[model samples]
Target: MDQSISSLHMRKLCPNLEREDALDTVLEVPLPEEMFPNRKGGSSSSSTDQDNHYAWLKSQAFNKATDTPPPMLSGRTAELQLLLSVIGSPLIPMPVPFDTAFSNRSVCESSIQASTAKYILQQYIAATGGQAALTSVQSMYVVGKVRMSSSEFHMGNDNSSAAAAVPPSITRNGKSEIGGFVLWQKNPELWFFELIMAGCKMSAGCNGKLAWRQSCSEKSHASRGPPRPLRRSLQGLDPRSTANLFVDAVCIGEKIINDEECFILKLEVSPNVLKSRSASSFDIIRHTVWGYFSQRTGLLMQLEDSHLLRMKSGCSRISASTQISCKSINNDSSIFWETFMESIIDDYRYIDGINIAHNGRTVVTLFRYGEGSINHKRRLEECWTIEEADFNLHGLAMDSFLPPSDLKVDCD
Candidate 1:
């Protein structure tokens, strides 16, 4: 995706460059021999190079026996899984004095609402299955089915003619891939999640001290922030963990969701937390989450979150006067991308005295905007239905939660 985006930028920047020259400048590779073969005076060496290039391209496109997933589809699958894993996930916040007040009383009333949030959480705990029952559980296992679909994308920045000429790939109103996941969790930060869809697999887990994720498109990499809870926990699979997650959240008031009165608990990641997750070239500007708890049933009915990120990239500019002399243009300015996700939970079923949402739907939107790019948006939706669930699994162990040895662990 990055490479493709880079190519688009190059095309815009150097429209006058020949196609072969453009490929050479951007990809640092000669244009494909199929499209631009050597001419008349070409030597045997050039012919040999062409033959080798074609062979390499064929090899990349044709390995029938290998289990490696197709690059395009695999990349998309991995991307979808990454989006699902962090939909409404948040970082733990440091507690503040309840008596503290800010100049903007209405905007920063979290301190005053802390107690109310706690009381609401207690009610939630009691409603799910009292604290005693929740604390007694040490492990859990769940299996669920999901259907995911993505819509074709277009940028308003693109010309109307180009937009009209672009064939539709997929739409929000199109077919979806059906798949399922198996999840295992142990007390105090030990958990494993595996999702399989469209013949591609993605897995993530926590080994108490470290959290990591892996997929067909990428090697496993340790998470950036202090080990966060697995996204599955918020799906009503682990009431205890879910309760603890919002312990520091503030009651933002009540709202009617799906005809049911619900209390909204809101939590925003602190700047420090966002800083920890940011890379040198990318900044996580903001991440905020909200959970809607049913006032009548004291059950979680919906979860929503939004995140904003800014990334900076630099590209070189080639001069028409001297193709040999290239100048680095800070033209790679900062671009902001945002993602918003909302999940609606329903069909709650009692499993071992605990309320588990057997059916749910999640919709995610990714918006690309900021410097030099037109606002482009794409949407993905996933509906999940639980098929099986069991608590206190007997044989789940720390060994099963260990990060893969082949994975590279990011520095704290």
Candidate 2:
């Protein structure tokens, strides 16, 4: 299962990007070779660089690997893992809120905060082409390019041993590696996502009942808790799904984003969902989301997702992002990791009567704390722009969103 989506394959799945009505944007989704540069002093080609690194890692090094993961072979590995933990398994607000709202429009009329959010959501729906246009859409295929990088984990105390485990090569300065992604969606619950970068790739999908994620380095694994829409879809790719996400949300306040005053609607992931995602390795503390809708445009300008989970005592393990779950010597006290992710959605332009967000940036910050006063902070970032979008595909089928056949239950 190579799982790489070629441009030709994408072109066949969706409408032409060069249509007479196409926007000015070229939406270049270049091949990986052109996307990620050589870490081998720019002499070897990307494929050669990748093959050489794979050889080096597999030769004698990978065979005698230690608990501490490799820092960086070149142009990235450690950072790739950080991405796999975050972007590879990204999730949006679930779509269950609509049931209560549609069943009874005044379901939560007693709460002012809830009522205010409903008002904001209505305006948002109208701004993104209204309920009529949104409902007409059945499926979508989105292609886009992205640049990503991660910062080294900074320790507040003298944790030299832990620092050694996280190699310095994993950190990028300002420049980041380029990558591309392809997403096919039938709805919030049924969708497929794939992203390739830095000689690493990841894919995840949900078949309306089960969700699973896989990467170049790891086996396919189930996502914990209830199924949720891909976070990328909410970056203005799917307005209907976004509206469904905030159906029962409450508007607490307003803020200015990108110089635009916006109303903020917030929602907390229910306790049942949190408990479902919990496992023997860790317990999810909270997963909250806040959407900022621009007052002038009435469209969502930004989204912020904050998540917290603590590793259970007596359990020693590391996550895809090794820095996120550093192994502790003492098992008596649990180590807590808080991840704050924010996406500033912008560059909205209509494609086939649907206003889709053409550009956006996502920033993820991770904080780790536990016994021995251990504290650390790390950041990962991604900037993406859509190249093309086609909706209501002719051959789109439910089989496309099926979970991997070899999917293993998530251990965390």
Candidate 3:
């Protein structure tokens, strides 16, 4: 491989951080295993594979589209984009918020569990920051760093193997990919998120009415249902959205997490909402969210959500138009994939009188079922920390949240 190509790839991995945050700070992505010598002290054997990944990540056209939506990003590279950016996220996006996420539960007045959940949320609002403080700010932005990786995979009992061996491509410990993200939010419905990992930059945003996502060299795809909110935002970054998301939740019960007893609030996606997000090729069977609020502190300590998807048989390719999520799937048989994600929020500190979690870890499990002799389980995880956060910025306008020009809306 040309040395220039590798050097160029190195530069491409460097993110353009804010001027204040840029000094002495550099973004680092783990070099492909091929970059180093083999365990036997010989040259690594995977140079060709590494070169292709590097070349695609820094392709001039793709990077150009990331900075200014190129006139086109053809389908030729969609598979590569999907392979490099496989993240599992709920497809149903967040519901549109009214007065408040929690305040809209007047219809379910009779359920004792619902009332208990509401009370738990009310306490959370107070614990994070009083309603007065939370409502006082109109917008906020956060700068953070993240490491993501696919950690493990194993065949289910249906397969012949007693205990499936982990694939060579996957690190049993989920090899971590280091990157940084910049998040800007005006509200639950109007927001933008950009992330760069392994030298590829992917973005998802909602311009108040629509949510779309794009990976480098891939045309953007609008989400199917209502405007979406980035799941990362709800990870102790956006209190308002987090509060509103569980507004209709019912108290499922309590469980001790990390030695802290917490109240569990559960919410399920409505059938109509799921139907709206489903496309002809795939159906989102169910998506349910759970929030665990610390009983003693009255703050949310963890969040977990699981979603099941059934795709048309033989249509194996995961959609590239969706968020920089959706890892690859096998096409051998008609199968169902259930993705479960759990986020543990911690390192809380008061910023401007608001208690905010500065760091967290998320683990995602993707399980394949509905097919005998083909069940597989893959595990992925992400660790993230907030480096900077600020509220009430004056210059962030609706334009900041616009979708790309080449964006294709998937549904009405």
lDDT of 3: 0.62
Pairs that clash in candidate 1:
none
lDDT of each: 0.59, 0.69, 0.62
Residue-level lDDT tens digits of model 1 in 1-412: 2112112110101122555433212111221222111234221211111112112111122111123312222223333443334332222222222212211224344466886777787788888887778777888877677777766665555676435322342222434766666777787777777765544445778887767776544556777766777665676677787777776689989999899999999988889988877765457889888889999999998888888876544222223442332123223334567778788988887888888889888887877665444456777788888877878764455787889887676532
- Write candidate 3's Cα lDDT for 1-412 as tens digits: 1122133122111323556444232243333433222234222111121112222222211210022212222222222233334442232345746447444447454589988887888899899887888877688778777776664456566433323222233324433567667777885467777765544556778897877776544457777777767777788977877888887779989999999999999889899989887766567789899899999998889999898876443222223343232222233333567778889999988888777899998887777665422456767677889988878665566787888897778532
Candidate 3 weakest lDDT stretch, 10 residues? 57-66
Which one is best on lDDT?
2
For candidate 1, what's the RMSD?
Answer: 17.5
Question: What tens-digit string does per-residue lDDT give for candidate 2 at 1-412?
Answer: 1233343122225245577454333243445465544545332212221222122222111110134333343434434655655754477745444323223377443498888888888888888887778878888888888888777657666656555544455433535777778898885468888777755667788888777777655667777777777889888998888888888788999899999999999999888888897776567889899999999999999999898876554323333443433344335356677889999999999987888899999999877776633467778898899987988776577777888777876445
C-alpha RMSD for every candidate: 17.5, 7.4, 10.5
Superior candidate under TM-score, 1 versus 2:
2
The Cα error of candidate 1 at residue 284, in Å, is 0.3
Question: Predicted candidate 3: what Cα RMSD to the true structure?
Answer: 10.5
Q: Where does candidate 3 stray beyond 4 Å?
A: 1-93, 101-108, 157-174, 314-333
Each prediction's total of clashing residue pairs, residues at least 3 apart in sequence or on different chains, is 0, 1, 4
